[model samples]
Target: MDNTVEQVNVLCIKWGDKYGSDYVNTLYSMVSRNLSRPFRFICLTDEAGGIRDEVEVKDIPKIGFKDFDEKHPWAKAHGWLKLTCFANPLYDLQGPTLFLDLDIVIVGSLDKFFEPEGDFLVIKEWDKSDATGNTSVFRFEAGAHEDALDYLKQDANKATADVRNEQEYITQFVDRQNKLKYWPEQWCRSFKRHCLRPFPFSFFQQPRIPEGAKVIIFHGKPHPDDALRGRSGKWYRKVLPTGWIAEYWR
Candidate 1:
Protein backbone atom coordinates (compact mmCIF):
# COMPACT_ATOMS: atom_id res chain seq x y z
CA MET A 1 0.00 0.00 0.00
CA ASP A 2 1.29 3.48 -0.89
CA ASN A 3 1.31 5.74 2.14
CA THR A 4 1.23 8.80 -0.11
CA VAL A 5 -2.16 7.89 -1.57
CA GLU A 6 -5.13 9.75 -0.11
CA GLN A 7 -7.22 7.46 2.09
CA VAL A 8 -11.00 7.47 2.22
CA ASN A 9 -13.15 6.47 5.21
CA VAL A 10 -15.56 3.54 5.34
CA LEU A 11 -18.01 3.61 8.26
CA CYS A 12 -20.57 1.23 9.78
CA ILE A 13 -22.61 1.34 12.99
CA LYS A 14 -23.64 -1.47 15.33
CA TRP A 15 -25.73 -0.70 18.40
CA GLY A 16 -27.91 -3.65 19.34
CA ASP A 17 -27.52 -7.42 19.50
CA LYS A 18 -29.35 -7.79 16.21
CA TYR A 19 -25.85 -8.05 14.69
CA GLY A 20 -22.70 -9.39 16.31
CA SER A 21 -18.98 -8.63 16.09
CA ASP A 22 -18.62 -11.16 13.29
CA TYR A 23 -20.70 -8.86 11.08
CA VAL A 24 -18.24 -6.04 11.70
CA ASN A 25 -15.19 -8.24 11.32
CA THR A 26 -16.41 -9.81 8.09
CA LEU A 27 -17.39 -6.41 6.73
CA TYR A 28 -13.89 -5.15 7.37
CA SER A 29 -12.40 -8.18 5.64
CA MET A 30 -14.68 -7.86 2.63
CA VAL A 31 -13.99 -4.14 2.31
CA SER A 32 -10.27 -4.68 2.57
CA ARG A 33 -10.41 -7.13 -0.31
CA ASN A 34 -12.69 -5.07 -2.59
CA LEU A 35 -11.52 -1.48 -2.17
CA SER A 36 -8.33 -0.62 -4.03
CA ARG A 37 -8.01 2.86 -2.55
CA PRO A 38 -6.09 3.36 0.67
CA PHE A 39 -8.93 3.40 3.21
CA ARG A 40 -9.69 3.39 6.91
CA PHE A 41 -12.40 1.06 8.26
CA ILE A 42 -14.26 2.47 11.24
CA CYS A 43 -17.02 0.90 13.33
CA LEU A 44 -19.15 3.00 15.63
CA THR A 45 -20.75 0.83 18.26
CA ASP A 46 -21.84 0.53 21.88
CA GLU A 47 -19.87 -2.65 22.46
CA ALA A 48 -16.53 -3.37 20.81
CA GLY A 49 -15.37 -6.38 22.79
CA GLY A 50 -15.08 -8.86 19.91
CA ILE A 51 -14.29 -6.49 17.03
CA ARG A 52 -10.93 -6.87 15.37
CA ASP A 53 -8.05 -4.56 16.38
CA GLU A 54 -7.40 -3.42 12.80
CA VAL A 55 -10.72 -1.57 12.70
CA GLU A 56 -10.74 1.86 14.33
CA VAL A 57 -13.45 1.53 16.95
CA LYS A 58 -15.31 4.61 18.15
CA ASP A 59 -18.35 5.30 20.29
CA ILE A 60 -21.52 6.11 18.42
CA PRO A 61 -21.79 9.88 18.19
CA LYS A 62 -24.68 11.23 20.27
CA ILE A 63 -27.59 13.07 18.64
CA GLY A 64 -28.59 14.78 21.93
CA PHE A 65 -32.31 14.09 21.80
CA LYS A 66 -33.86 14.67 25.25
CA ASP A 67 -35.65 11.32 25.30
CA PHE A 68 -33.46 9.43 22.89
CA ASP A 69 -32.84 5.76 23.63
CA GLU A 70 -31.87 3.10 21.12
CA LYS A 71 -34.18 0.55 22.75
CA HIS A 72 -37.19 2.85 22.85
CA PRO A 73 -40.20 1.72 20.84
CA TRP A 74 -39.97 4.37 18.12
CA ALA A 75 -36.20 4.46 17.93
CA LYS A 76 -36.03 0.68 17.82
CA ALA A 77 -38.34 0.54 14.82
CA HIS A 78 -36.74 3.43 12.98
CA GLY A 79 -33.03 4.00 12.29
CA TRP A 80 -32.98 7.39 14.02
CA LEU A 81 -29.59 6.69 15.55
CA LYS A 82 -27.94 6.69 12.15
CA LEU A 83 -28.49 10.44 12.08
CA THR A 84 -25.60 10.77 14.48
CA CYS A 85 -23.16 10.02 11.69
CA PHE A 86 -24.06 13.38 10.19
CA ALA A 87 -23.01 15.28 13.32
CA ASN A 88 -20.67 18.17 12.64
CA PRO A 89 -17.01 17.32 13.20
CA LEU A 90 -17.70 13.58 13.15
CA TYR A 91 -14.82 12.31 15.27
CA ASP A 92 -12.06 13.88 13.12
CA LEU A 93 -13.11 11.88 10.09
CA GLN A 94 -12.86 13.95 6.90
CA GLY A 95 -13.17 13.83 3.11
CA PRO A 96 -15.40 11.38 1.23
CA THR A 97 -16.82 8.88 3.75
CA LEU A 98 -18.92 5.94 2.68
CA PHE A 99 -21.46 4.49 5.15
CA LEU A 100 -22.58 0.92 4.62
CA ASP A 101 -25.08 -1.17 6.50
CA LEU A 102 -23.56 -4.17 8.26
CA ASP A 103 -25.74 -6.66 6.41
CA ILE A 104 -24.54 -5.93 2.88
CA VAL A 105 -22.16 -8.06 0.79
CA ILE A 106 -19.54 -6.34 -1.37
CA VAL A 107 -19.05 -8.24 -4.64
CA GLY A 108 -17.14 -5.78 -6.88
CA SER A 109 -14.54 -3.05 -6.83
CA LEU A 110 -15.33 0.02 -4.74
CA ASP A 111 -12.82 2.50 -6.21
CA LYS A 112 -15.37 4.04 -8.55
CA PHE A 113 -17.61 5.18 -5.70
CA PHE A 114 -15.21 8.01 -4.89
CA GLU A 115 -14.77 8.93 -8.53
CA PRO A 116 -18.35 10.19 -8.89
CA GLU A 117 -19.12 13.91 -8.69
CA GLY A 118 -21.66 14.53 -5.99
CA ASP A 119 -21.83 16.25 -2.61
CA PHE A 120 -24.18 13.58 -1.27
CA LEU A 121 -24.92 10.30 -3.04
CA VAL A 122 -27.20 7.45 -2.00
CA ILE A 123 -28.97 4.41 -3.44
CA LYS A 124 -32.27 5.38 -4.97
CA GLU A 125 -35.12 3.41 -3.39
CA TRP A 126 -35.90 0.47 -5.61
CA ASP A 127 -39.53 0.15 -4.49
CA LYS A 128 -40.56 3.78 -4.42
CA SER A 129 -41.33 5.97 -7.40
CA ASP A 130 -40.53 9.15 -5.48
CA ALA A 131 -37.17 10.79 -4.80
CA THR A 132 -36.63 8.87 -1.57
CA GLY A 133 -33.32 6.98 -1.22
CA ASN A 134 -32.19 3.89 0.61
CA THR A 135 -29.41 4.69 3.06
CA SER A 136 -27.91 1.19 2.97
CA VAL A 137 -25.10 2.66 0.83
CA PHE A 138 -24.40 6.38 0.88
CA ARG A 139 -21.43 8.72 0.67
CA PHE A 140 -20.82 12.29 1.79
CA GLU A 141 -18.19 14.50 3.33
CA ALA A 142 -17.81 13.57 7.00
CA GLY A 143 -19.16 16.83 8.40
CA ALA A 144 -21.14 18.20 5.46
CA HIS A 145 -24.72 17.44 6.61
CA GLU A 146 -24.96 18.57 10.22
CA ASP A 147 -28.06 20.57 9.48
CA ALA A 148 -30.01 17.38 8.95
CA LEU A 149 -29.05 16.17 12.39
CA ASP A 150 -29.70 19.60 13.91
CA TYR A 151 -33.19 19.65 12.46
CA LEU A 152 -33.94 16.28 14.04
CA LYS A 153 -32.52 17.36 17.39
CA GLN A 154 -34.68 20.48 17.41
CA ASP A 155 -37.81 18.38 17.78
CA ALA A 156 -37.41 14.64 17.99
CA ASN A 157 -41.13 14.10 18.36
CA LYS A 158 -42.12 15.89 15.18
CA ALA A 159 -39.23 14.43 13.27
CA THR A 160 -40.17 10.87 14.15
CA ALA A 161 -43.81 11.49 13.40
CA ASP A 162 -43.19 13.14 10.04
CA VAL A 163 -41.05 10.46 8.44
CA ARG A 164 -41.20 6.71 8.16
CA ASN A 165 -37.50 6.23 8.90
CA GLU A 166 -34.17 8.01 9.19
CA GLN A 167 -33.28 7.60 5.53
CA GLU A 168 -36.48 9.35 4.43
CA TYR A 169 -35.77 12.20 6.83
CA ILE A 170 -32.25 12.71 5.54
CA THR A 171 -33.32 12.32 1.93
CA GLN A 172 -36.01 14.98 2.28
CA PHE A 173 -33.58 17.32 4.02
CA VAL A 174 -30.83 16.96 1.40
CA ASP A 175 -33.30 17.13 -1.44
CA ARG A 176 -34.63 20.37 0.00
CA GLN A 177 -31.14 21.85 -0.31
CA ASN A 178 -30.96 20.57 -3.91
CA LYS A 179 -27.87 18.55 -3.08
CA LEU A 180 -29.31 15.03 -3.12
CA LYS A 181 -28.07 12.57 -5.75
CA TYR A 182 -28.20 8.81 -6.30
CA TRP A 183 -25.71 6.16 -7.39
CA PRO A 184 -26.21 4.36 -10.66
CA GLU A 185 -29.18 2.00 -10.39
CA GLN A 186 -26.99 -1.00 -11.16
CA TRP A 187 -24.51 -0.39 -8.37
CA CYS A 188 -26.29 -1.04 -5.09
CA ARG A 189 -28.87 -3.78 -5.49
CA SER A 190 -31.38 -5.22 -3.00
CA PHE A 191 -31.22 -8.97 -2.49
CA LYS A 192 -34.94 -9.32 -2.02
CA ARG A 193 -35.85 -7.28 -5.05
CA HIS A 194 -33.10 -8.02 -7.52
CA CYS A 195 -31.72 -11.40 -6.67
CA LEU A 196 -34.41 -13.73 -5.43
CA ARG A 197 -36.59 -15.40 -8.02
CA PRO A 198 -40.32 -14.71 -7.89
CA PHE A 199 -42.84 -17.11 -6.29
CA PRO A 200 -42.86 -20.50 -7.99
CA PHE A 201 -39.49 -19.97 -9.59
CA SER A 202 -37.86 -19.32 -6.23
CA PHE A 203 -38.72 -22.87 -5.15
CA PHE A 204 -36.42 -24.42 -7.71
CA GLN A 205 -33.74 -21.78 -8.28
CA GLN A 206 -30.99 -20.38 -6.14
CA PRO A 207 -30.51 -16.62 -5.91
CA ARG A 208 -28.12 -15.09 -8.41
CA ILE A 209 -26.05 -11.91 -8.17
CA PRO A 210 -26.98 -9.23 -10.62
CA GLU A 211 -24.44 -8.00 -13.16
CA GLY A 212 -22.53 -4.76 -12.46
CA ALA A 213 -23.65 -4.75 -8.84
CA LYS A 214 -21.02 -3.61 -6.38
CA VAL A 215 -22.94 -4.16 -3.17
CA ILE A 216 -25.79 -6.53 -2.38
CA ILE A 217 -28.04 -5.20 0.38
CA PHE A 218 -29.82 -7.65 2.70
CA HIS A 219 -32.44 -5.27 3.92
CA GLY A 220 -35.71 -6.80 5.14
CA LYS A 221 -35.31 -10.54 5.30
CA PRO A 222 -33.04 -13.41 4.30
CA HIS A 223 -29.82 -11.77 5.41
CA PRO A 224 -26.46 -12.89 4.12
CA ASP A 225 -26.21 -15.62 6.72
CA ASP A 226 -29.70 -16.88 6.01
CA ALA A 227 -29.03 -16.92 2.27
CA LEU A 228 -25.78 -18.78 2.79
CA ARG A 229 -27.71 -21.54 4.58
CA GLY A 230 -30.87 -21.41 2.47
CA ARG A 231 -33.20 -20.07 5.13
CA SER A 232 -35.95 -17.85 3.82
CA GLY A 233 -37.68 -15.81 6.50
CA LYS A 234 -41.02 -16.20 4.80
CA TRP A 235 -42.86 -19.45 4.44
CA TYR A 236 -44.03 -18.60 0.95
CA ARG A 237 -40.63 -17.55 -0.38
CA LYS A 238 -38.37 -20.51 -0.93
CA VAL A 239 -34.66 -19.70 -1.09
CA LEU A 240 -32.11 -22.33 -1.99
CA PRO A 241 -28.65 -22.25 -0.46
CA THR A 242 -26.51 -19.76 -2.35
CA GLY A 243 -22.88 -20.83 -2.54
CA TRP A 244 -21.64 -17.63 -4.14
CA ILE A 245 -22.23 -15.62 -0.94
CA ALA A 246 -19.31 -17.52 0.57
CA GLU A 247 -17.13 -16.38 -2.33
CA TYR A 248 -17.30 -12.66 -1.49
CA TRP A 249 -19.03 -12.16 1.89
CA ARG A 250 -15.98 -13.45 3.77
Candidate 2:
Protein backbone atom coordinates (compact mmCIF):
# COMPACT_ATOMS: atom_id res chain seq x y z
CA MET A 1 0.00 0.00 0.00
CA ASP A 2 1.20 3.51 -0.87
CA ASN A 3 0.13 5.24 2.39
CA THR A 4 1.02 8.63 0.84
CA VAL A 5 -1.46 10.78 2.66
CA GLU A 6 -0.22 12.78 5.65
CA GLN A 7 -3.10 11.66 7.87
CA VAL A 8 -6.49 10.10 7.53
CA ASN A 9 -9.68 11.54 9.01
CA VAL A 10 -12.63 9.39 10.10
CA LEU A 11 -16.23 10.64 10.29
CA CYS A 12 -19.50 9.17 11.56
CA ILE A 13 -23.03 10.54 11.81
CA LYS A 14 -25.55 10.29 14.65
CA TRP A 15 -28.97 11.85 14.75
CA GLY A 16 -32.10 11.28 16.79
CA ASP A 17 -32.11 8.69 19.62
CA LYS A 18 -31.67 5.50 17.68
CA TYR A 19 -28.03 4.89 18.64
CA GLY A 20 -26.72 5.97 22.02
CA SER A 21 -23.55 8.03 22.42
CA ASP A 22 -21.58 5.01 23.65
CA TYR A 23 -21.49 3.71 20.08
CA VAL A 24 -19.55 6.86 19.20
CA ASN A 25 -17.26 6.55 22.19
CA THR A 26 -16.46 2.89 21.58
CA LEU A 27 -16.01 3.40 17.85
CA TYR A 28 -13.37 6.01 18.57
CA SER A 29 -11.39 3.51 20.61
CA MET A 30 -11.89 0.71 18.08
CA VAL A 31 -10.74 2.82 15.13
CA SER A 32 -7.81 4.20 17.07
CA ARG A 33 -6.63 0.72 17.99
CA ASN A 34 -6.96 -0.70 14.46
CA LEU A 35 -5.39 2.10 12.42
CA SER A 36 -1.81 2.77 13.45
CA ARG A 37 -1.46 6.11 11.66
CA PRO A 38 -2.20 9.72 12.40
CA PHE A 39 -5.98 10.09 12.18
CA ARG A 40 -8.83 12.27 13.37
CA PHE A 41 -12.10 10.73 14.47
CA ILE A 42 -14.95 13.18 14.05
CA CYS A 43 -18.53 12.55 15.06
CA LEU A 44 -21.15 14.64 13.27
CA THR A 45 -24.06 14.68 15.63
CA ASP A 46 -26.77 16.69 17.34
CA GLU A 47 -25.99 15.25 20.77
CA ALA A 48 -22.52 15.26 22.36
CA GLY A 49 -23.23 14.48 25.98
CA GLY A 50 -21.81 10.99 26.47
CA ILE A 51 -19.11 10.71 23.84
CA ARG A 52 -15.61 10.41 25.26
CA ASP A 53 -13.54 13.60 25.74
CA GLU A 54 -10.79 12.39 23.40
CA VAL A 55 -13.01 12.30 20.32
CA GLU A 56 -13.63 15.43 18.26
CA VAL A 57 -17.33 16.17 17.95
CA LYS A 58 -18.84 18.33 15.23
CA ASP A 59 -22.43 19.34 14.59
CA ILE A 60 -24.09 17.74 11.64
CA PRO A 61 -23.75 20.30 8.89
CA LYS A 62 -26.86 21.77 7.32
CA ILE A 63 -26.21 21.10 3.63
CA GLY A 64 -28.54 23.92 2.52
CA PHE A 65 -31.39 21.79 1.28
CA LYS A 66 -34.93 23.06 1.83
CA ASP A 67 -36.11 19.65 2.97
CA PHE A 68 -33.78 19.85 5.96
CA ASP A 69 -34.65 23.51 6.58
CA GLU A 70 -38.30 23.09 7.53
CA LYS A 71 -37.78 19.99 9.72
CA HIS A 72 -40.12 18.07 7.48
CA PRO A 73 -40.81 14.31 7.73
CA TRP A 74 -38.35 13.48 4.99
CA ALA A 75 -35.41 15.60 6.17
CA LYS A 76 -33.07 12.65 6.29
CA ALA A 77 -33.93 11.76 2.71
CA HIS A 78 -32.77 15.18 1.55
CA GLY A 79 -29.32 13.66 1.73
CA TRP A 80 -28.15 16.56 3.88
CA LEU A 81 -26.00 14.67 6.39
CA LYS A 82 -24.56 12.29 3.85
CA LEU A 83 -23.66 15.38 1.83
CA THR A 84 -21.27 16.46 4.55
CA CYS A 85 -18.74 13.73 3.73
CA PHE A 86 -18.22 15.28 0.29
CA ALA A 87 -17.39 18.62 1.87
CA ASN A 88 -13.78 17.62 2.50
CA PRO A 89 -12.86 17.67 -1.17
CA LEU A 90 -14.46 21.08 -1.53
CA TYR A 91 -12.24 22.03 1.42
CA ASP A 92 -14.95 21.87 4.07
CA LEU A 93 -12.62 19.44 5.81
CA GLN A 94 -8.80 19.33 5.74
CA GLY A 95 -7.96 15.82 4.57
CA PRO A 96 -9.21 12.46 3.28
CA THR A 97 -12.18 11.05 5.21
CA LEU A 98 -13.86 7.72 5.59
CA PHE A 99 -17.57 8.17 6.45
CA LEU A 100 -19.19 5.54 8.60
CA ASP A 101 -22.60 4.76 9.98
CA LEU A 102 -22.72 4.98 13.76
CA ASP A 103 -24.37 1.59 13.97
CA ILE A 104 -21.22 -0.17 12.70
CA VAL A 105 -18.71 -1.88 15.00
CA ILE A 106 -15.06 -1.82 13.88
CA VAL A 107 -13.79 -5.40 14.10
CA GLY A 108 -10.39 -4.90 12.41
CA SER A 109 -7.96 -2.37 10.96
CA LEU A 110 -9.19 0.19 8.43
CA ASP A 111 -5.81 0.83 6.78
CA LYS A 112 -6.71 -0.68 3.40
CA PHE A 113 -9.62 1.67 2.84
CA PHE A 114 -7.17 4.57 2.90
CA GLU A 115 -4.57 3.06 0.58
CA PRO A 116 -6.81 2.69 -2.49
CA GLU A 117 -6.37 5.38 -5.15
CA GLY A 118 -9.50 7.08 -6.42
CA ASP A 119 -11.58 10.25 -6.45
CA PHE A 120 -14.11 8.47 -4.22
CA LEU A 121 -14.15 5.14 -2.40
CA VAL A 122 -16.73 2.96 -0.61
CA ILE A 123 -17.43 -0.59 0.42
CA LYS A 124 -19.24 -2.84 -2.04
CA GLU A 125 -22.56 -3.96 -0.55
CA TRP A 126 -22.67 -7.73 -0.57
CA ASP A 127 -26.32 -7.78 -1.65
CA LYS A 128 -25.76 -5.53 -4.63
CA SER A 129 -25.94 -7.25 -8.00
CA ASP A 130 -23.71 -4.76 -9.80
CA ALA A 131 -21.81 -1.64 -8.60
CA THR A 132 -23.71 -0.53 -5.54
CA GLY A 133 -21.98 0.57 -2.34
CA ASN A 134 -23.54 -0.32 0.99
CA THR A 135 -22.50 3.10 2.29
CA SER A 136 -22.05 1.66 5.76
CA VAL A 137 -18.40 2.57 5.09
CA PHE A 138 -17.04 4.92 2.44
CA ARG A 139 -14.18 7.40 1.91
CA PHE A 140 -13.70 10.50 -0.19
CA GLU A 141 -12.20 13.96 -0.33
CA ALA A 142 -14.41 16.70 1.08
CA GLY A 143 -16.24 18.86 -1.44
CA ALA A 144 -15.16 16.63 -4.33
CA HIS A 145 -18.76 15.62 -5.00
CA GLU A 146 -20.62 18.85 -4.39
CA ASP A 147 -22.53 18.19 -7.55
CA ALA A 148 -24.24 15.20 -5.91
CA LEU A 149 -25.83 17.43 -3.30
CA ASP A 150 -26.48 20.10 -5.90
CA TYR A 151 -28.14 17.59 -8.18
CA LEU A 152 -30.28 16.23 -5.36
CA LYS A 153 -31.28 19.74 -4.34
CA GLN A 154 -32.20 20.60 -7.90
CA ASP A 155 -34.65 17.71 -8.06
CA ALA A 156 -34.94 16.74 -4.43
CA ASN A 157 -37.85 14.38 -4.77
CA LYS A 158 -36.66 12.93 -8.05
CA ALA A 159 -33.25 12.10 -6.65
CA THR A 160 -34.54 10.15 -3.69
CA ALA A 161 -38.09 9.19 -4.58
CA ASP A 162 -37.39 5.51 -5.16
CA VAL A 163 -34.21 4.65 -3.38
CA ARG A 164 -34.36 3.01 0.05
CA ASN A 165 -31.28 4.63 1.65
CA GLU A 166 -28.42 7.14 1.28
CA GLN A 167 -26.02 4.51 -0.10
CA GLU A 168 -28.17 3.97 -3.16
CA TYR A 169 -28.54 7.61 -4.09
CA ILE A 170 -24.94 8.59 -3.27
CA THR A 171 -23.29 5.66 -5.03
CA GLN A 172 -25.41 6.13 -8.16
CA PHE A 173 -24.68 9.85 -8.13
CA VAL A 174 -20.92 9.24 -7.86
CA ASP A 175 -20.91 6.32 -10.25
CA ARG A 176 -22.31 8.53 -13.03
CA GLN A 177 -19.12 10.61 -12.90
CA ASN A 178 -17.06 7.45 -13.57
CA LYS A 179 -14.82 8.43 -10.68
CA LEU A 180 -16.12 6.34 -7.80
CA LYS A 181 -13.98 3.39 -6.69
CA TYR A 182 -14.34 0.57 -4.17
CA TRP A 183 -12.03 -0.99 -1.59
CA PRO A 184 -10.43 -4.37 -2.23
CA GLU A 185 -12.85 -7.28 -2.34
CA GLN A 186 -13.80 -8.65 1.09
CA TRP A 187 -12.43 -5.68 3.01
CA CYS A 188 -15.99 -4.89 4.10
CA ARG A 189 -18.47 -7.61 5.04
CA SER A 190 -22.09 -7.64 6.10
CA PHE A 191 -23.00 -8.63 9.65
CA LYS A 192 -25.37 -11.20 8.27
CA ARG A 193 -22.44 -12.58 6.30
CA HIS A 194 -19.78 -12.49 8.98
CA CYS A 195 -21.64 -12.63 12.29
CA LEU A 196 -24.91 -14.47 11.96
CA ARG A 197 -25.46 -18.17 11.87
CA PRO A 198 -28.27 -18.82 9.36
CA PHE A 199 -31.55 -20.62 10.09
CA PRO A 200 -31.75 -24.43 9.92
CA PHE A 201 -28.01 -24.19 10.58
CA SER A 202 -28.79 -21.81 13.44
CA PHE A 203 -29.34 -24.63 15.95
CA PHE A 204 -25.59 -25.20 15.69
CA GLN A 205 -23.53 -22.58 13.90
CA GLN A 206 -21.45 -19.46 14.34
CA PRO A 207 -20.53 -16.45 12.19
CA ARG A 208 -17.22 -16.65 10.41
CA ILE A 209 -15.52 -13.31 9.99
CA PRO A 210 -14.23 -13.03 6.46
CA GLU A 211 -10.44 -13.22 6.04
CA GLY A 212 -9.77 -9.69 4.76
CA ALA A 213 -12.77 -7.84 6.09
CA LYS A 214 -11.92 -4.76 8.11
CA VAL A 215 -15.51 -3.87 8.95
CA ILE A 216 -18.79 -5.69 9.16
CA ILE A 217 -21.88 -3.58 8.52
CA PHE A 218 -25.13 -4.21 10.36
CA HIS A 219 -27.61 -2.54 8.05
CA GLY A 220 -30.99 -3.68 9.38
CA LYS A 221 -32.02 -5.54 12.47
CA PRO A 222 -29.89 -8.16 14.26
CA HIS A 223 -27.42 -5.40 15.05
CA PRO A 224 -24.12 -5.92 16.83
CA ASP A 225 -25.98 -6.03 20.13
CA ASP A 226 -28.44 -8.59 18.88
CA ALA A 227 -25.63 -10.64 17.35
CA LEU A 228 -23.74 -10.58 20.63
CA ARG A 229 -26.75 -11.72 22.61
CA GLY A 230 -26.68 -14.91 20.58
CA ARG A 231 -30.27 -14.12 19.92
CA SER A 232 -32.05 -12.08 17.29
CA GLY A 233 -35.17 -12.81 19.44
CA LYS A 234 -36.73 -14.23 16.32
CA TRP A 235 -36.60 -17.83 15.16
CA TYR A 236 -32.81 -18.19 14.86
CA ARG A 237 -30.59 -18.28 17.92
CA LYS A 238 -27.61 -17.04 15.92
CA VAL A 239 -24.98 -17.51 18.57
CA LEU A 240 -21.53 -15.97 18.46
CA PRO A 241 -19.23 -14.87 21.25
CA THR A 242 -20.97 -11.78 22.55
CA GLY A 243 -17.51 -10.44 23.38
CA TRP A 244 -17.14 -8.74 19.97
CA ILE A 245 -20.26 -6.64 20.38
CA ALA A 246 -19.61 -6.04 24.09
CA GLU A 247 -16.43 -4.28 23.02
CA TYR A 248 -18.35 -1.92 20.72
CA TRP A 249 -21.14 -1.23 23.18
CA ARG A 250 -18.49 -0.21 25.69
Judging by lDDT against the true structure, name the best candidate: 1
User: What is candidate 2's CA lDDT for residue 10?
Assistant: 85
The number of the candidate with the highest TM-score is: 1
How high is the CA lDDT of each candidate model? 0.88, 0.73
For model 1, residues 4-114, the per-residue Cα lDDT tens digits are 767899999998788999999999999999998899999988899899999999998766665443446666456767777887788999999999999999999988888
Q: Estimate each model's TM-score.
A: 0.95, 0.88
The number of clashing residue pairs in each candidate reads: 0, 10
Give the per-residue Cα lDDT of candidate 2 at 232: 64
The digit string of per-residue lDDT tens for model 2 on 59-137 reads 7766677665454566655234666555434324666788887777777777777787898788877777766787878
For model 2, give the 10-residue run with minimal summed lDDT.
Answer: 83-92
Clashing pairs in 1: none
**Candidate 2 total steric clashes:** 10
RMSD per model, one decimal: 2.1, 3.0
Candidate 1 off by > 4 Å: 1-4, 69-73
